[model samples]
Target: MQLLGPAQENLTPRGMKARGALAVMGTSVNMQIGRPRLQDLLFSERDQEQGAASIRQLLREIRIALGPHRDAVVTGPGWVGLDGQIVALDMAGRAGADGRRPEFAADLDIADPEFEDWLRDARSHYEDQADDQLAAGIADDGTPALILQAPMSGDLQAAVTAAMILQEAASRVGDVLPLHVVHGDPGIGKISLGIELGALANRSGNDIVILFAARLRSDGRLLWSRRFVLPAEDSAAHLRRVAGGVTVAILHGVEALREVVTDPRLRRMPLQDVFSYSAVRLRRADEQLAQIDPNGDRAVILALRSYIRHTMLLERLAKNPQEEEEMASDMAARARELSPGNPTALGVNAMVAAWKGQSETAFDMARHAIAIDDENPIARLAYSSALTGMGHHREAEAEASAAHMSALSELGPAAWVLRRAIAATRIGDLRSAERYFATTHGYAPENRPALRFLSAIRYELGDEQGAQAALQKLKKLEPDFTLELMASDAYPVDSLRRAGLLKITRSGLI
Candidate 1:
């Protein structure tokens, strides 16, 4: 994954709007910052207006811009939440107690000692309320008043306050540059939140530019495509050149940009930090894959097959959302078609099928994959999972053993360990199941199956607290999950395994 950078003067604005903002010195300015996506600019100012004419124009322009993808574009602003609920912020500032626009007393000074205390109290109140609602798995209709920065306007009071804090710092000490560092676990929408904060700063009359490192060309221009290319120089050089303005650079994968933090020149740059973790899931599989191969270029498929397989493993852990499945299917098909008879692609197919409960299809594909590459660890794991799901515990155990014997020094796939645990559980070897479940959890701590099986095994072994701890993680990861959800699925359909699951359910493992 690469960082995405800002587009310089490559294309003309398809359109422009005159935005008015009050300047810091009490004067008015007519100016606007460029949005990363050109299309978002079309409707960026709608919330501040009160006429149907603008909305109608937005629709007409969208029709022209989308040409072939209009239906998907015209869909409402709502997004699917982690719980599969349609969620959209109330952008009109027209609902709930928190909907009221935040205000500061006219006499308050930025240097006042009480200012920090007041800001902390206010932020804590809002954040705690949002946290409570999330923890309780509250329905969308019943959720507490929350403060999410509007995607269009980026006018959340918190974001505004954050910008003010930066401005104060910049003024207090010369060259105390305002660099905000927003970091989070993989799929928690860090980029969007950072952009929103950047938008707030721009609207506050700061010359802020948002860019993605992944899009930066060798000549320091941003390429307006999904393709990623390594920069000719470190991204910090590009940032230093834009020293006159505030810059919000989106780093798609933090690891890929380690130089920014490790290199002496960049490491010394002053930065305000923001980190968030949902304690739920990894980043979205599509976003992750896009970072890996955003443009779908055909030439590097085989060269990147290992990375693709690693992403595929993440897809399985993420429950294989439709977009992920479609992307995986297309990539898997290409991997196979481009390199026919390759064991890796066949193994990937079998794994995908196994996740979708296509047991027989998975079994057949795994057999074919293994026949072509018996020593391939992925094929061995796929065969093991398929065999377990098909009620061949003995055969599955043998396959898992083979995979273990040939496994790399690094931990093998969690799915492989999971299959072994399932076989052990089925064969009434609870001790062995417990050990493998522990290994599975070590390999993929957030994996639901590993957590679930570990919980059940702990309960059976009389480690009630350990079981409860695992269950709590499950609760946080999948709030609506119940023990009944584990009943005799195609993945583990043996009568013995079904009984074991039923007993675990009765034991209140959920």
Candidate 2:
């Protein structure tokens, strides 16, 4: 999802109070960059150490700004760590814990170091040193401290560091021309994280202005959107322009870099996504991957998805996340294209159709997916969805039940059971509904739907008091109950009042 608004013109004084840090995340489907997500990299000892060293260097300069108020920087100056590092949480969450801040945070960096000396439109040139380090961490003495946060959720520290590194790397090109690439995987929140970092840097009053390839709309602008085309051989120059104009250059997508590398005219424009300096292979670098968790399917999916997203990100491919259930279809398609025998690739076509309201297509894919590998969980779920959509009530119930039975406890069973119960209710099989609820109750006692649906079934069978009791429990389970939520969208009319099957004298109907 897009962020709420355009990047603030300034890192406003108000903006300083936030858990502010960019997250660098991308998938590892093809494992190009190696790691599943950039977040994975942040958790590593290597990144933590590098981040700490970089932050310390930045902080040392910042301490100069605070001058005489240095000792008052910390909430309590006398506290010490086990070895005298001085613990912030020593006051018990009052000051800090590792990097958790009770207040806000700010940051600064020369987005590109190589271009640091490049002259902008005017005589002024960007300095390689950071310009806005003063706002990083505020001192308790009314001065600011350089607050270096640890890598928490979303791999925030890595994101900031990546921007820093990327900027420096761009400068090394020495071309002093247009072009820069901001490549990464999909849904790893790359766009947002990049936006945050660029915005954070710019807000610190860095002179850098992101040059968009096109003018940004109001909404796009809020996303810190910028557009530009890099010269075939002018990759470094363009970056220098953006960096020289401002303290940092903000590149939005990988395509930005692709232009420079693939340019036919440039002699030094990277012939490939690589740069060689000493032991470093900067371009076309294989991402270092994290260890996989055999128990997590989503993790596996993410690992795969990252690669696909990265391809698109770097290739400048278009995407539509809201085209209704297209993710599975896209995944299935890619799985076949990339690794057909993987078993997970079989039923993609059907899943896509089903998501688009094509029951028949959904059913067909589901069957095909199962025929290829009945034991496949994703395939089974896809098949069950198709069956339900096609009104194969009995088959849907059986298949969903089978899915539940086949799944591991580590993968909770309630969602599958709920699908089956919905099918039973749709078919008006009162007995079937009763059985489904019974099974659900035993397996998941806390399942609210089991009690509520059982109540509805009892009412259908003419057990007035039993129905009344179920409704009361239902009320406890759902204080603001309505027939609409309890039923499917296929109901003939808007409310239960229109249904010939049930009678409700008051309240909203399904």
lDDT by candidate, in order shown: 0.42, 0.37
* Candidate 2 lDDT tens digits, 1-510: 011111211111112111111111001112122222221222233365564454334334333433442331221232111111211111111123222222211132223332122213111211221122212222112210111111122333333432443454333221111222233212111111111123222211222322222111101222223333333333444553333222222222222423322323222212122211111222122221111212223222322333233222222221443432244445546555554443334444555566457788778767876776565545666687688777677788788777676522113355467557766776677677767776766665545556656666666677667666656665654455556545545322221222233443222322
Query: Where is model 2 poorest over a 10-residue stretch in terms of lDDT?
Result: 17-26
Candidate 2 — what's its lDDT? 0.37
318-340: candidate 1 lDDT, tens digit per residue: 25556665666667667667655
Candidate 1 off by > 4 Å: 1-292, 297-320, 407-415, 461-463, 484-499, 508-510
Off by over 4 Å in 2: 1-355, 400-411, 419-423, 426-428, 445-452, 464-481, 484-510
Per-model clash counts, in order, read: 10, 45
Q: Go through the candidates in order and give the C-alpha RMSD of each one to the true structure.
A: 21.8, 25.2
Clashes of 1: 10
